[model samples]
Target: MPPISPNELSDEQRPFDEHVRQVMGGLRTPFTSTDESGALIGPFPVMLRFPGLARPLLEWFTTVTSGSVLSPRVREVAILTTGSRYGAAYELYSHSRIAAKIGLPDGVVAGLTAGQRPAGLTPEESVAHDVAAHLYTGAPLPGALYRSAVACFGECGTAELVFLIAQYAAISMVLNAYDVPLPPDAE
Candidate 1:
């Protein structure tokens, strides 16, 4: 789908667009949420196409991102794992940059994008990756892995990790379904 330029947005979409820009602007994102022409990028445009549903999802996204207790590295590991599993190009593109910007090594980012488990992860990062990898298999997280996650992250952090995985999985599906392309620079 072609991006809907800002000028073409309906009254209903305008507020949602503004909210998206506002939220994204406040985040330490490695990506540009709008293109050079000021169109919303990635799933933002797709969400704007359906404001009723997008509103709640955007709220959830805001809460997940702003209120999360997980470390940025853990969050990115789960996100990269989920995005790679779904082959969500934009998610992978954007988060890979975020991951690198946050100091994840090039090899590690390359491995995750390729859907392989890379070595050199700290114990915490390994647990995060394991949690996401297990979740991607569509089977229940194994008892051992669950215990490991909780042991490393505590009950609340473990729960947040799972939710993060689920959220990124949903985003991955949206990006893939819409065939959202990467920004021209990324390509």
Candidate 2:
């Protein structure tokens, strides 16, 4: 882990930190897009200031919980796929650990990180990776990709998968634009 801890921040964030800690009911890691990030990135929580970010994030949760396109394993795979294509250090740091926590085998995660989408992936997972790669690289999603996605996930699931990919791609943009380095010990 890099030296990204928020040292000297609590000294300035006493009240804000306390309020967030009480509300969130734990050691509130300061939202990186706001306040002092130590080494994370930016200031002003993306949602707290921008507000509109909540809509897509909520939709992402809803779509994932919809249990159509986003099995936990598949979800992690898609995240890793786009994170690599976009070079999203932040999402990679976060989701790599999550992939492990959600039970992705180490070998699979390692392979995906290298942009090799691995053999033996379920068809749906394979298409999700392909879609992510194409979208990141500025290619049109071919009909075959959409058809396979729909076949595996159905129409709604395909839509949700696209939504998730687009949302995370936007997030990757923010991080990359701002050079949002990873939080210390984050992965």
Candidate 3:
């Protein structure tokens, strides 16, 4: 889908567009959320096309980013694993940068983006990756793995990890379904 420029937004889309721009602009994100002409990049434009659905999803996204109990590294690991599993290009592209920015080694980021378990993870990070990897297989998470995650992260943190995986998986599906491209700089 071609990007909808800010100037081209309809009345209904304008408010949501402004909300998105304001929220994204306030974040310390590692990736670009807009293009040279200021069109929303990645899934933002697609979301603007359906404000009813986008509003809640954006809320969930904000909550996930702002209110999550998991560490940034753990969250990014789960996201990269899920995004790679779905082959969601934009998802992978964006989170790969985030993963790096948060001090995840290049090799570790590369491995996650390739859907492989990278070595040198802390116990918490390993648990996060395993949880996401197991979920990617479309099977129930094994009892042992779930127990381990709980042990490492506590029940609340583990639950947050699982929810983060589910959220990113949904985001990945959206990016893939809409064929959202990486920013022009990605080329």
Candidate 4:
């Protein structure tokens, strides 16, 4: 079973029963890809079903993390680091472009993909990368890394880090569960 399943709960169409819709925002795309139909899971139908319910949340998440909180550079680092942690091919492939665009060092990106310690990392980026890896590995992040994140982000930034991590991790889980493949044109 998924850690959280949108399928199990029927939308009462009630405002409170709209966690999925809230997460999805006002997205109207079909639950699955148009090319083919298969088992459905994760944040699809909820989006396709109620854009009014889903749109706001989708916008909230996108705007908050990617647009406002983390700089494009930091955002790309966090995402690519998380993708590397999980060995999620789609995430890695997708973020590589974003990371490059944001000027993330190529060495750091490659090191993350190989699961090796990278050289020439700033303290903040290093902490975030390590913490993300620790999360995926089920190992407790060391006190030093946590302290480093606190030092780098301060209180609010640290909170945003957790939020960003959880969001991406949720996304990865959904993709993996559904075996969501990259689009044919993905590059």
Indicate whether candidate 1 or candidate 2 has the larger lDDT: 1
TM-scores for all candidates?
0.96, 0.69, 0.95, 0.65
* Poorest 10 consecutive residues by lDDT, candidate 2: 38-47
Tell me the deviation in Å of residue 55 in model 2: 6.7
lDDT of each: 0.90, 0.64, 0.88, 0.60
- For residues 59-99, what per-residue lDDT tens digits would candidate 2 score against the true structure? 46444545554687777788889888888787777677777
Per-residue C-alpha lDDT of model 4 across residues 116-182, encoded as one tens digit per residue:
6588667677777767777777677688878888888876787787677767776666557556566
Q: What is the lDDT of candidate 2?
A: 0.64
Which residue pairs come into collision in candidate 4? 24-54, 25-54, 25-55, 26-51, 26-54, 26-55
Please tell me which predicted candidate would have the highest TM-score against the true structure: 1
Arrange candidates by TM-score, highest first: which order?
1, 3, 2, 4
In angstroms, what RMSD does candidate 1 have relative to the true structure? 1.0
Query: Over the stretch 53-98, how does candidate 3's per-residue lDDT look in tens digits?
Result: 9899888878767866788999999999899999999988888888
- Best of the candidates, lDDT: 1
The superposed Cα distance between candidate 4 and the true structure at residue 143, in angstroms, equals 2.9
Give per-residue lDDT, candidate 3, residue 147: 97
